[model samples]
Target: MRLPEVEDTVNGPFTMIWSLLLSLFASLTARSVVNGQTPAGLAPKAFLSLPLGTVKPAGWLYDQLVVQTNGLAGHEHDFYHYVSESDWIGGTSYYSSLEEAGSYWFNGMVPNGILLDDPTIQSQVQQFLDYVLDHQDSTGWLGPEVNTTKPRYLWGRYPFFFGAIQMVEANATLTDRVVTAFHKFVALANTMLHNGEGLEDWTRTRWEDFVIVLQWLYDFHPEGNEDLLIDTMKQLKYTGDPWEDVFNETYFPKTAVEDLRNPFPVLTWHGVNMAEGLKALPSTYRFTHNQSDIDAASKGWDLLFQYHGRPSGIYAADEYLAGLEAARGGSYLYQVIGDPKFADRVERITYNALPATLTGDMWSRQYLQQQNQIAAKNMTPNPFPEDGPYSNVFGLEPNYPCCTVNHPQGWPKFISNSFVTTPDQASLVQVYLGPYTVSTMLAATGNKVSVSVDTLYPFSDTLTTTIKATKAFTYYVRIPSWVTNGTISVNGGPSRPVSPTNGLHAVSVHAGTTEFTLDLPSEITIEERPHGSVAVHRGPLHYAFDISRSSRVLAQNAQQPLAVDLEFDATEAWQYAIDPSTLTFHTGTPAGGQLPSPIFDSGLPPFTISVAACPIDWAEGGNTFAAAPPTDPACTGAVTNITLSPFGSTKLRIGEFPTFKAT
Candidate 1:
C-alpha cells in the first residue's frame, strides 16, 4: 500500500539535528526533562534500548514460550483461518489470533532462534514476515472492510492496531506500510467519530488501543510528522473526553467490590479493557506533554493497586471488575512510567498469576484467577459476575478465547521490554530482572554496548551482568525497595548497601569489559491480607500450600495433552490454616543451593517451606475460594506440619491462607 507522503509540519530537517544535539547538552535533561518538551525530547532513545529478538528466554521461561509456539501461538492459524474474509491476515473475527501469532513469532520464535541459533524457528519467523508484507492492501488497511451485516459491530480495529505494533517490532521496512494504513483508517474513523457514528460497544471500550500505537509511531518517526500523528490522535473518538471521565469520575478499583453485587456495564468494566487502558493516558502524554495526563495514569493505577491488588501483584478484573486477580497488566504499567514499584509488581504477577493461571505448559488459561483460588473447574455458581461456568477451567477456549490468544503476550513482551535507555542515551535502565542479553547503541559516546545477564531471577537472589562495550556507559540498575540490605559490586568491588535515586542504582563503566554482581537477600515476610489471612513471601516469590491433584483431559487438539489443554482437580483437602510463627524455609538443592528441576511444576516445587498448621472449618463459596478467609477460623485438628511451595509452581493450591491462633 502506497499513500501520499505526509509533509513535515513541526520544523525543518536542520531543526531535527539541533534538537538532538541540544538534548545531549541540555542541563534539564538530567533524569527529568523540563515539563513541556516533546516526548522525543525526553523520550529514551529506542536505538539505545534492546530490540525484542535480542534477549532469548532460558530455563522455565524458554520452556513456557516454546510450549506456546508448539500449541496456540505456533499452530493457531491451521485450525482457525481469519484471512478468508478479505484474503488478508487481519480480515475476519479471528483476526486477533493473527496479531497474537505475529507477536508470538516476533517476540518468542525469532528471539529463541537468535539465542540458540536454531534454523527452524528462524525460518518460521521469516515466512511470517514475508506473508504479512506481501499481503498488504493498497489502501493500507490490513484487515477486511467493515462487516456491516454482522449483528455485533466492532468498529475499533484492534487487530490492525495490535498487528501494526508487531510490524514495528518485527521489521522496520513494514513501518511505512503500517503508518500509511493507519493514516487512511484514522481519517475514516475520525469522520465517523465526529459524526458520533463510529464508536461501537467493544470499540469504545478499547478506544485507547489506537492511541498507544500512534504514540509509538510519533516518537519513532525521524522526520517531523508531529501534525499527522497529533491529528490522528484528535480524530479518534473518546481519545479526549471519555478517557478523561475515567481518569476523573471512574473510581473503579474503589467501587469494584460493591459493584460486584450490582454489576456495571461490561463495556467499561471488562478485564482486558482495564488492563490495556492503563496505557491510554500515559501514551497520550507523549504528544500532549501534559504532566496532568501522566499524573492521571499513575494515580489511576495507584488506586487500582491499593483497592483491588491481588497477592500476585495483578489487579482484579475477571470478565467485569471481579477483584484483584490475574489477566496480567502489571508490565504495561512499568513500561509506561518506568517505576520500580511497577517493575516489582510485574515480577510478582509474572512469576505467580501468569504461569499459575495457565497450565504449566502454557496451553490454556483461566479467565478469572485469584490469589486464593484452590480449584480450576467449571461450576454452576461461580464468583465471577458474568463469565461462563468454564471461566476457571484450563482449556483452549475455556470461558472466552480472548485469553487463549491474549495471555501469550504477557511473558514475550515482558522479556522484550526488559531494558530501556535514558533520554540522553548515555544510560540504560534495567527494569525487569531476568536471564537475557541487551544490545544498544550509546548515542552520547557513539558506542554499541551489549550486556548479557545470566541468573535464575525470582528463583535466586543473585544476578551477574557482563558488559561488552566499545566504550564506557552508565547502566542504571533497579534495586527493589523490599531489598533493604541489597548490594551492587562492580568488578568484584566491596559489597556495600547502595542508595538508589528514584529506585535506580547507577554504575559507571570504564573502557573494556565491566562485570556487576547484585546480591538480593531473601527474607521471610508474612503479609496480612483481607479478613486476618496472611500471605508468605520470600523476596519476590510467594509461597503457596502444596496440594495433590488429579487431571482429566476435557479438550485438546493434536499437541501433547499435559503441555497444552487439560484440567486438574484437587485430590487432597485444601482447608488448612497455617501458623505463621512456625514457618521454616529451606533450599531444595545443596550444590549452589539452586532451584530443583521443573521450576514451576505443580506438587514438586523447586524450593520448599515447612509450617505448622491445622485443619480449618473454612468452606468454599460460590464454587471459588471464599472471597476472604474467615476472620478467625476455629482449628479443627492437631497442629501438624505442612509443606509449602512457590506460588507459581502449584496448579491447585492455596496462596492466601486463613490464620488460627494456637492455644
Candidate 2:
C-alpha cells in the first residue's frame, strides 16, 4: 500500500489514484509495524515514551521516592483498602482502594520497584494483582458486579484500565490478560453508552480517561487488529463537555487573571477533571490525526497556564482550578507532548511545589500550596474555592482523598519520563535533568545503548552522562531558554558553548563508550507575580525566605486511625519585605544533621544560601497569605541576615516576597 505523499507549500497536490495507492501502502505498512514492534530507524520528531523501567532513578530522585515509599504509596493498604468500606484487598465502593492500588502500581511499583525493593511494596502489589485477577468477572470487569446503587457509572474502572496498561508496558506477559479484560469492559461500556444506562456526571466529563486506555491498547495491542478500539473511541467521544470550545473562548484566560478567586462553573472548575481533560485532544488526535485536535490541545494548555499557572509551574487545583495555588497538571501535559517546556514545568513543580506540599517524611500533603504561603493551618473559610477548611493543612486526606492517592504519581512519573526515545527509537530526548540509568535499543544501528547520568541536579547545575552503545546515535539535550551560559564537553574534549534553539542541543557521537559533561549556570532572576509580589528562582529551583516554624498534630486518626494530620503555626514574623537588588547571597555546604535525612530534605539540604535583607512593614491576615506584597511597605526594622533555601526545602516559607526601597 502507498501513502498519499504529503506536499510542502511549494509542491502541488497529488492525483486521486496516487493518493489511494499511497493510502493502501501506508495501511499495510502500519499493520506490519504495529502488529509487531515498531520498526527501528523511523525516528519522528518527539513525544514517544520509553517503556517502564527503561530508566532507573538514582541519587536525589531515588532518595525522594524512598521517602515516599516510607510514607503513602508503599503502605496505604495497611490502613484501609482502595475504597472505604472494603477490607485490605477488595472493596464494594467503585473508586476507593481500587483506585489507590492501580495508581500505586503504575506510578510507584513497576517503575521504581527494582530500585527500592521494599517488602511492603512487593507484598501489596502482589496482593492487589492477585485480588484483581481472581475477582475479574467473566464479562471483563475487574471488580464489583453491576449494581443498582451505581449501575452505568463507568468511571470507577479507569484505575484498573490505566494500571493494567502500565503492567503490560512493564511486563509483556500480562498483555493478554489485560487486553482481554479491557475488551470485555469496552463491550459492556459500548452497550451502556448506546442504551444510555448509567453515565454519571463524572463518567461523562471523565470519558477522556476511558479514551486514553483505548488509545494505548490500539497503539500497542499485541494483535494490532483492534477495530473495537475505534468503536470505543466513538462511544466516548461525545461524553464530555467540549473542552476546546470553552478553552477557545475567554473563559479560562479571563477568569485566570481577573477572578482567580471566583469558582468556575461546574463543568470547568474541577481540578483533577481539568488535569485529565488535557488528554481530550491528544487522545482524540491519535485516532483522527486531525491537526485541529492537536492544535486545540495546545491552545487549552496555553490558556490554563496563562491565567491559572502558579510560580511552582503547576496550575492551582485546590479541588477546583484555583488559578494561583500550585496543583498537579503540567506533568500530564508533558507526557502527552514531549515539549521541553512541559518537562521544565514538571521539573520546577517536582523540585519546588511538589515536595513543599508534602511533609519532609512524605507523611502528609497540603491540598493547596500558594506562592506566598506563610502559614499552613486549618481555617474555617479556607482559601480554596471548594476544598475543606483543612485544605491548606498538612495531613493525610486533609481536604479530600484524591490528592492523597494522586500525589504519588508526580515523582515516579517524572522518573519514568525523564528521558524519552524518539518515535522510531533513533534518538534519546532528555526531558528533565536528573541522575538515572537508561537502557534501550537504538534504532539507528539496531544495537542497544545504556546511559547512566550522574548529577545533583536542580540543587546543582552540573550533569555528567556516560554512554555505552553498540553503535553511535544522536543525543538531544534540552537547555531551557532561561539558561544563558550553557556548555557541553564531549569525552573530556574542549568545552563548547551551546546555543539552544527551541531548548534543544543535538549531538552526534561515535560508536563505543563516551562521556559528556554539561554545565549550566543559573542566574538569579525575580519574576513579578499576582499583586506585584516577586518570586526568586535560580535554575528550576525556586527560592524562599526561611521562616522559623513549629508544628502540632491537630488530629490523630483524623481521616483514618493510622493517619496523623498536622497544623503549622508561624513562630517568627512573616511580613518582612526585602530589596531584590540589595540582596547578597552566601553559599554553604552540607551541615551534618540527623533529622530531614537524605540531604535533599529541608533541614539537611545538600546546599544552603544566606541572603542579606531588612525587615519592612508588610500586612498579613486572612485565611490566605497576604493577597499581595504591600505596595511600597515602610521599613519596619534594622537590616538583617536571612537564609534562603530551595522552595522544596521550606516547610513554612515566603516564596513570593515584597520589595521595599533601601533607606
Candidate 3:
C-alpha cells in the first residue's frame, strides 16, 4: 500500500515508528571483487593524490559544515542564527534536527575521506542510519512517519537529497562492499517490491532532487536495481509539472518546482542542478540508450547558457528559483550536479563572480538572495519607500546569510573535481595547464589504467597525457567547442581521427596506454554570447592589454562595456603576436612608447584585454575587462611589456570590454 505522504516531511514522532520497518532496505549486496587483478597500467599509490585534488575542497567544506552542524567550527562571531528555528544558515539548520542532521552527517562527512565502515564517528551516526534502516520495508522505502495530516504533499527534506550524494561516493569504489546491503534496505520501501507503494504521499515530484542521492546509490550498484528506481520515478511523476509553459520546457528542464507552483517566469535554475542534470545524462546514452535525453540535456545547456549564464562562465540559480542575475538572486545550485559542461561553466563563472564576491577576503556578495517575492538584489533591503534596493558591500550581515558561507566552496572544488572515470569509459583530457593524473578500471576491457596529463592551459596550449595501462583498452579527451584547428599526436605519432562533437571534442584511445600531444593553432575568435563582447584568445591563453603604460589603473574610466561588442574600433584595434618572438606572455601598455601623458588629465585611463582572454571575463563582476583602481599587487605586472598576469591573480582591473568607435 502507498505509505502516508508526511513521511517525507519534517522528522516528527512518526520517524521513530517507521524506523523499525525499513532495516532490510538499506543492505545492498556487493559485486564480484578481483583479488589481485589490478589493471595493468594502474599507477603507484603515490600518484593517488591526483584524483584527490578535485574532491578535497568539497570534502573539506563538507567537513566544516559538519563542524558547524555539531557546533564545532565557525568563529563564534561568524556562527549564523535564525528566528524560524533556533539557528540556521538561511532555512537550513544542520544542528539538532535529525533530517538535516542526517544530511550534515552523511552528505558532508561520507564523501569527506571517511569510510562508511570506519569506526571513528560510526557509533552515533550508525545509530541514526541503522535506526532508519531497521524500519525500511522490503519495498525499499524507509523513513520516520508520514505527516499525511496536512493537505500539502511532502516534496522532500534535505536529508533525502543529501543521502543521494553519500550513496554515490560509496558505490564509486569496488571496496564499498556494503552497497548491496543498502539496496536491500531500499527495496523494502520501493513501490515495485511487494507491499511497497512508492515515495508515498510526496508522489509525482522530486525526481532530480531524489537523484542527488540516487547518483551515489547507482554508483554503488553499478548494475542498478532498475525496478525500484523506475518505480520511484513513476509515482513521483503522477502529474509531472506541466512543461506546457515555455518556462519549464524551453528553459532549464525544471530547476525544481515549489509545491507545484511555477511562480517566476525569469530563470534562476542554473548552476547546481544544471551540473547535476548534465551529470545524470550519459555521454552516449546510459538510460535506455535514448537520444531524447541527450538532446534535452543539450538544449538545457543552451537555455542555462542564456538566462542563468553569469559573467562567470557558470550559470546562476538565484537563492532557490530566482531568475539568473547578479545581486539578490545568485545561488550555488550547479555545485553537485556532476556534469562536465557545468564544470566548464563554473570555471568561467569564477573568473567574474568569485572575485566580485571576495572583494578582499570574504568581502563580496554580488549575487543577492531573498526569500520574499520582490526584487531586492544588491540594492538595500527596502520595501516601498521602506527598504532601499542595492547592497554596496559585504559585512557581518549581508542581505542573505546562506550564500555568504556557501560561496567559498566554488573555486577549490571546481579545480579539484575537473575529471572523473566510469567503470568502462573515461573522460578525454580537454585542457591541461599542469600535471595531473586519473585512475579508473574500464568495464569494456576489464583493464585498469592511470592517465597523467601534463601541460599549462589558458596559458599554454600544448600538453602531453601519458597512459599507463594494465591491459590494452581505449580512453578519451575532450576537444573543446572553442578550438577550430588543433593537432593531436600519440606518442609523437601522426594525428589520427578523433571523433569531433560540435560543442566539445571527445577523443577516444583504442590502443592501451600511450602519451599524446595536442598542438593547437592560435587565432582571434570573438566570444559568442548575447552580450556583444569580443575577446582574443591564442590557444587557451586569453590576451589582455593595458592602455596605461604608467599604472594598471586605466587613465580612462570611460564606462566599460556590459558585453563584448565585436564591432570594436578598427584604428585602435587591440592585437598581439609572439611579437619580438622572445616575449613569453602577451601584454601591452599605452600606445605612445609611454603612458601617463597629458592624457592622464583626461581621467581614468581607458584599457581593455584582447579577445584572447577567456569568455567568462566579459560579464560584470568578472575580470575587470576595462580598468580599476589598483589594489592588487599583480596589477603592477601591467607594465609596458608583453607579459600577462596569472588569470587567478589579476585583482583590481577592468574586464568587460565595450564596443569602441573611432571619431
Candidate 4:
C-alpha cells in the first residue's frame, strides 16, 4: 500500500539547510574540542554530542543509574555465561553462532560504567578493551571471526567499535591504543568489502552503523588516512540496502507489516532494524550531500509514526515493525537536523516507553512492551508475529537475550546525550530536561562551564540550573513543545515568560556563579485514540491506571540470587474506563530530600492524578494481550475514584482505556 506523502513541516529542505549553515558557522569559529572533533567533511550537525562521562546523572536520575549499577546491567557478566565466558573475551562459550552477545554487553556497559563513574564497571570495561585490543589478528581484523573461507558477518563489530569509540572519547588515555587498533581493522575491512568477503545479509542491511564509526574515525583520528575511510564508507553504502531510495520511492511499507501479503521484506520490517535504519538516509546525506536524502529521512520519520506510532512514542515491532515495542531513535536525528520535534520524540520515548520495558528496580525487562499491557506472563497465541509466548513477560531473558543486554544503552545514552554543545562550541545546548550536571570547556570562549540541574522533572514543573563558568557563554535550554506558557527567572528575579527560538530558550550568563529556574506548567491532557479509547498525558509522562499487582518469582540464578526472573499479575480489578472530566493532579516532595534508590519504583513519582472511573468489560485477546479498547465500552460497575500514576512507575497498567458515559 502506498502511504500518502507527509508534508515536511518540522524539517523541511529550507529549514534543514538553514540549521546546517548555523551549525557550520559555529563549527568554524568554536575552539572547544571538549565534545570531540566536529564534522570534518560531512554535513555540520546542529549540536555536537559531548564525550561520554562529560554529563553525569544527578539527583533522582543519579539514583536511577545507581539502581542500574546494582541491578542486572552492572552484574550480567558476573554469572551470565554470555558475558562471563564468551568468545569475544577468549572463552570457548558463545551466545550463538554469531559472537554478538558479548559485544552487546560491552556496548551497553561502557556508557553505564562511564556515566556512573563506577570504578568496578570501569575496571571491567578496561579489562575487556585490553583483551580485544591486544588480541588483534595479523590480518588487521578484530574479534574472533577471522576465517577467510566461511562467510563472516561484520554486524557485531559495529556495536563493539561504537562502544570503543565512546571509551576513547571519555578517557583520552585510551586514544592511541584504540586508534591504532581501528586503523588495522579498517584496512582489513577495506580489503574484505572490496573482495566481497565479510558483508552478509545483516551487514548489508545495517551498514549505516559501520559508516557512522568510520565517520567518527575520519573526523577524530584519521591518521592521514581520510581517503581510506571515505572509500570504505562508499563501499559500504554501495553494498548496503538503499535506505534513501527505500524512503524516497513507493517501496516503503505503509501498513502494519503483518497485515501485508506474504514474502515480507524481512530486512525492512524487522523491528530493531527499522529502529536503527531510521538514521540511514540522514547518515547517507552526510557523505552524498544530497537534499533528497535529507528530505527522505524526514519523510520516512513522519510516515513511520503516522502509520505505526503508539501513544507511548514508539512503534509496534514485536520483532516486526507493526505494533508497539520499546524501541526509539531520534536523539541522533535531533543532533543531525536540530529539530525540536526530534528531541521531543526522544523525550517521549525516554519518559514513557523506555521505562515501561524495565521493572521499576531496573533488574528485569520485557523483550516487548505494549501500550496497554494488562499482565506480564507467558502468552500463547499472542499478537506478535515473530516473538515467543514469553516475549511480554518481565524476566532476565524474557523472550530473547538481545533485549537483556541491549536495554542498558537506553538510559545511559539518554544521560550522555542530554547535554551537548553547539558546533561553534560557544553555546551549550540542553537537549533534554533531567537531573544531571555538565562540566566541559567551550572551545570558542575557552571557558570552563559547569552546570548542575536540580529537580524531579516531568514529575515536577520546575528545574533549577546552577551555572559556574570561568567566562561568559550562552546556555540554551530546550522548551518542549508540550509547554504552552513556560517562564524562566534568574537569581530569584521576577519571572519572565519564555520566548523560545526553534524550541530552545537561550540565556546569557556572566563569568561567575549564576542560577536560573525554569517553570514549565503542566496540564492534564486527554488524547483521543482509535476506538473510543483515550490516553492521558501531563508533561512528558503518560499517565496510566496503576492496577495493584503481585509478583511471582519464576526463576533465579543459582550463583547470584539477586538476579531473579519474575512475572507480575494484576491482583485487583484493572478494567476501568476513566472520566476525564473529574481528573485532578496532585504533587508532593520526597520524604527526606532524597529520592528512592530506584526512582521509577511504584508510588514514588512524587505526583499523582485522581479521576473517576468505572469497571468496563474490556476483552483480552489471545488469553494474553489486552485487546484494543471497545469502540463503545459499557460501564459494568459504579463509577469510583481511581488513582493514575506515571506510566513508567507501573508494572501492570492500563495506559489506554475505553471511556463510557456515566448516568
Candidate 5:
C-alpha cells in the first residue's frame, strides 16, 4: 500500500517512502519466521520489571513520596488549568494537539498512587481511566480526537497508555478492560501507520513511545494477534526519525545548538526529544536483535554526556540542546542492557539531578536547572536557545507546562524500577539503593519472598536489607561503582569486603528471615571541571554550596492559593571558590532521632560537608546564570568555612565551583 507523502525536511522526500517499503518487507519476513518458528537474534532482557506496586517506599523515601502526593503531583488536577481541563479527561483545554499535559500527569500519577497506595490519587487516576476506557472510539482510537477527516496524532496516546498499562498492572479489575481497549487501539493504529496518517514531526521523532507499548502487548498479551503488533512496531520504527543515525558522531551536534551551523534541526536539537530518543536504539534492539543497534545506543549515551553533561548527571537542554539543563532516561537502559553503568547513572540522577529541579516539598519545580545555578529568578538573554526568560524560576509552569506535569514521574518511576527480578525469577536484584520493600513470589523456588531495605542512602553510607522467604533464594545487591572500600555482613557475622561482578554483589540466603548490613565507606572526591574548577561527590550524592535564598509568590491560583508560582532570589552573596583540601564531612542525629520528614528541605539534611571557601569575582551571565569559573581565580575576600549540602537539598546552589589554595 502506498502511504501518504509527509514532508521530510530532515531526511529528504524519499526517506519516508523508502523506510515504509523497507519496513513492509521486513515485517512480512518477520511474520513468516515468527509464525511457526522462533525468530533468530531476539535479545533477552537481563532483568524483568515487576508489576506496578510491587515495591513500596519506606523510611525517608516514603516521606518524599508523601510530599509529592500532597504537593502539585497529587493536586494538579484540582487547580492547575492544563491538567484540570485536559482534553484526555473530557475537557477542551490542552497545551497542544498532542494533549500531553494530562497524559504526563496520568503517567506519573499512576505509579505515584499505586506505589503509595494513596486512595485520593488513585481515585483521581481512576476517573480519567474510566473516561478514556469507556469513551474509546468505535474505530479503536482513544481520547477526545475522534474526528475522521482531521489528522490524528498517536503521540499523546503513547503516554496515556503508559499510565493505563501501569494501572492495569496494579489493579486486576482493570486488566481485561484496559487490555481489550488497547487491542482495539493497536488494530486501528496499525492501519493509521499503513496509511501514514499520524506520522508527523513530533510523533515521528518520538515513535519509540508507541513501539514500547506495542512490545509490551506482544510480550504479555498478544491474544492471537502477534503479527499485527509486530507489524505496527516495525512501521512505527521505520516511519519515525532515524535516531541511530542521528546519534552518530557525523550527525550528532558536538557543540550547543546555538553554536551549530545554520538550518538548525528542530527534533534533533530538542532536549526532551534527545532524552526520549536515547531509548530508541535500545527499544529497536529488542526486535531487530542487531548488535550495532546496541552499540549505537551505548555510544549515543556516552556522546551525549561527554559533550553536554552537567555535574548533576543530566545533560543540558533548556528547550534546544543547550549547554546544561536537567533530564533523565537511565532506568530503561539499565533494565534493557543490564549495564552496571546504566544503573550507576540512574542512581546519580535520582539522588542529585532529579530532586534539585524540585522544591523541598515537591510543589514547585524549575523548567531549567543548572549545575552552577545560583539564582532561580527570570533571566534575560539566557543560555537557552528557545526558552523564555522565566525558564529557571521555580513555578507551576515557569517557561512551559511540560516539565511541570512531566517531573512527577521521576521519583515514582525510580522507586518502581528500584527492585526487579532476574529473568528466571530465581533471584531478586536490588538494582539501586533506597528506602523500599519488595514482596514477590520467586518463580524458581515457588515461595514468597519479601525484602525490606532500611537506610538513609546517598545521605548515609549504610543500609540494612532484611529478606524473608519460605525457601532459600539468591539475592543480588548492586554495589555502586563509586564504592571502593565497602563491606557487607550477614546477621552479625564478621564483615567481609564486598566483591562485585559487574557492579553487583550476590549473596545466598536461607529461608525464614535473614538480614544483611552493607557499609559503603565514602570520602570526598573532587572531579575537575572544564575550567580550573571542581564538583564534589561522595557515593551517589553530589555536594553543592547551598546559597541562601528568599522566595516570593509570582503568581497564585485563585482556586487554590497553594498552587502558586515562586521566584527565588539569592539573599546572600553566591560567589565563593572552595578549597578542596579542607573539605570535611559531618553527620548527626535529627532532633527526633529519625531522619527529618521532609529530608530534602534546605538545611534539613542530617549530614553536612564543611569546606573552606573564599569570595571570588565570579561574573554572571546576563545577571542570572553564573559564568564558568575563571582559571586560577583570585580570592576577593578572606577564606571562611561554608556548609555544603546534598545537591538535591538546595534549590539555589553552586554545585560547580572554582578552586583555590587555602593559605
Candidate 6:
C-alpha cells in the first residue's frame, strides 16, 4: 500500500534535500520500514551516506553521556539507581522514563558508550551488570526478579544484558577493562539464557529481544554465543509480549484479544510500541526468517499509532486503552531514538507535561500526567508495591524512586540528541528549531564539525547553520519528511532538489562551504494515523485547545494552569471543503477532527487545563496508582468543582482539553 503524495508547499529547496535524504534512507534500509508505513528508516542504517552521522549520529548522545553516563542525580548506571521508574523511554528524568528507555536502549545502542568512557560511572554500571550476570544460573536466566517491579521490572533480562554490552562497546575506547568486564557479564547472561531454566521467567516471546542483542554482540565479538542468538529470535516469533500472570485478570486481565489460550506474549504488543518493533522481523527474519514476528509487530503499532495518535505526534497512552476518551501516559523514552518520528512525539510529551510536574526550574511534582488523572507527590514512608507513580518529580521518597532517579536522563539527552553527529560521518537534525548548536564527530577524519545553528524554526521557516568542518567530505543534512518547500545551500548559492516533493523524513547536503541556509515553508497540514483517528498537527507541532470552562472565563485571578483566548479562521476559516450533503469532514474536520494533543515534551510548554479535577488514582496531595489496589491511594470524595487544565500549565490539574465530542 503506497502512501499518497502530500503537497510540497512548505518550501522547495528544503523539501527537495530532505526528501533526498529520506529516499536514500528508504532505498538503503526500507527493509526495516513496514509496508504502508511512511518511507523512512527506523534505525541509523539510513545515514550510511554520511559515516560520521552513523557512527556518532545526532541526538542527546553527548548530553546523555555527560549527565546519565556520569551519574547525575543518583543514577549510577543503566536506566537508574532505583527500581520503580514509570513512563519508559521519553522525558528527561530517570525512573520516570522506563518503558520507552528499555526499548530505545535495544536499538539506540548507546549504553556501551558509558561502560568504557566514564570510569566512575562505568564501575557503577558494571557493578549492576556484574550482579545480574554473576547471579544467573546456567540454564539461561539472570537478574533478581526477571525485572518485574512495576515499570522497571517486567522487562525480560535480554535487554538489560544487551544494554550492558552496548555500554561496554561504547566505553571500550577508553579502556580494555571495559571489554573484559562486559565480556564477563555477557558470558554469564548468555550462559543463563541458553542453558538455564531462567529463560522461563519471561515468556518465550521476549526471546527475540535477547537474540537481537546477542546478534549484535556476536557480530562485534564473534567469540559470543551464536546458538543463543538464533534461539531467542526463534522463541520470540512463536511466543510474543510476555504475560505477568495467565490467570490474573485485574493486572493481566483478559481484555483485547482473549479466547486464544496464548495470545499477547508473542514478541509483540497491542499498539505502536509493539508494532514497529516486531514488524521488522522480515529484515531480521532472514538470519532466521519468521513472518510471525513481523506480522505481530506491525499489527500492534498500526492499531495504536492509527487510533491513538494524539495531536502531539505521539501515540497517546490511555493507559494501554485506545482512542480519545483515554487518559494520557505519553512517554517518548520507549520510542526508538534512531527514529525521529517519535522524537517529535518525545519533544511534545516531555516539554510541556513532563516539566509541568517539576518546579519552575524543573523540580517538584513527582508524578506527571497528560490528564489530571493523577496529581500527587510520591509520599515518603510509602512502601514498595504499595507506592504508585513509580517516578514522580516531587521529592524522592523510598517507595517509587525509579523515575526520581531515572527521569534525570531525559532532558540532557534530548538536548544532546537535538544536535546529533556521532563518531560516524553522519548527521540527523531531529527537530526544526533554533538556539541548538550541533556538533558532529566526523567518521572521515576522526575529527569534529562544530555547527552553530540559530533559527526561530516552527515560528519562522529559516534555519541558518555555521558548519565548521574538521575535514572535507560530502556532508548530508536532513529534510523532515513533512517539509514542502525546503531548500538548502552551502554558502547561499542556490538550493537543489534532493528529495521527493512531500514527506517528513528527508535530507540534503552541500559540498564544502562553512555557512549554509535551510529554508522551510509552513505548509501546515493535519496528519492522521491509520483508522481515521485525527491528531491536529502543523509540521511537528501538535496543538491543543485549553478548555478553561468550569474553571474561569479567563482574565481573572488565575491559579495554576495559564489562560488564553483562541480565535478560529472565519473565511475559508474553519469552513469545511465538504460535499456538504455528506456532512463528513467533507473537506475540513472529521469525526476525530478536534482530537486533543498529548502534552509532554523535553523542553516544550505544558498544557494544564484546570487543577479543579483529579484522576482515578488520588491521595492527599495528588493521584496514586497501585498494581495491587488494596493498598492504592483512595480518591477523596468528589463533590463541588472538578476542573480540567492544559497539559503544560498546571502542576495539579487535568488536561486542558476536556473530553468532548463534535457538535
TM-score for each predicted model, relative to the true structure: 0.83, 0.86, 0.53, 0.90, 0.92, 0.54
lDDT of 5: 0.78
| Residue-wise C-alpha lDDT for candidate 5, range 421-501, written one tens digit per residue | 888877788988978899888887697999899888877788999999999777888888889789988877777788777
Q: Show model 2 residue runs off by greater than 4 Å.
A: 1-45, 81-115, 146-148, 222-225, 256-265, 325-332, 558-562, 584-587, 591-596, 607-612, 623-627
RMSD (CA, Å), each prediction? 9.8, 8.5, 15.7, 8.1, 8.1, 14.3
Clash count for candidate 3 is: 138
Q: Any residue pairs clashing in model 5, and if so which?
A: 316-325
Give the 10-residue window scoring lowest on summed lDDT in candidate 5: 6-15
Q: What is the C-alpha lDDT profile of model 3 across 488-594, one tens digit per residue?
A: 76666677533443223334454465777865445544442223333333443332332221211112112221111111111221222112222243333444423
TM-score, candidate 1, is 0.83
Q: What's the CA error at residue 407 for candidate 5, in Å?
A: 1.6
- The alpha-carbon lDDT assigned to residue 165 of candidate 1 equals 58
TM-score-better candidate, 3 vs 4: 4
Residue range 464-570, candidate 2, lDDT tens digits: 98888888667777777567678888777777776455566766655898788888887778887665667777788778876778878887764455467887877
Q: What is the lDDT of residue 349 in candidate 3?
A: 48
Give the best candidate by lDDT.
Answer: 5
- For candidate 6, lDDT tens digit of each residue in 242-305? 2222112332322332122332332233332332343234334435333443343344434444
lDDT of 3: 0.34
> If the candidates were sorted by their lDDT against the true structure, best first, what order would they fall in?
5, 4, 2, 1, 6, 3
| Candidate 1 lDDT (Cα, 0 to 1) | 0.60
- Candidate 4, pairs of clashing residues: 26-424, 31-443, 31-444, 32-443, 316-323, 316-324, 317-323
For each candidate in the order shown, give its overall lDDT on alpha carbons: 0.60, 0.64, 0.34, 0.76, 0.78, 0.36
Query: What is the TM-score ranking, best to worst?
Result: 5, 4, 2, 1, 6, 3
Cα displacement (Å) at residue 211, model 5: 1.3
For candidate 5, what's the RMSD? 8.1
Q: How does residue 473 of candidate 6 score in lDDT?
A: 41
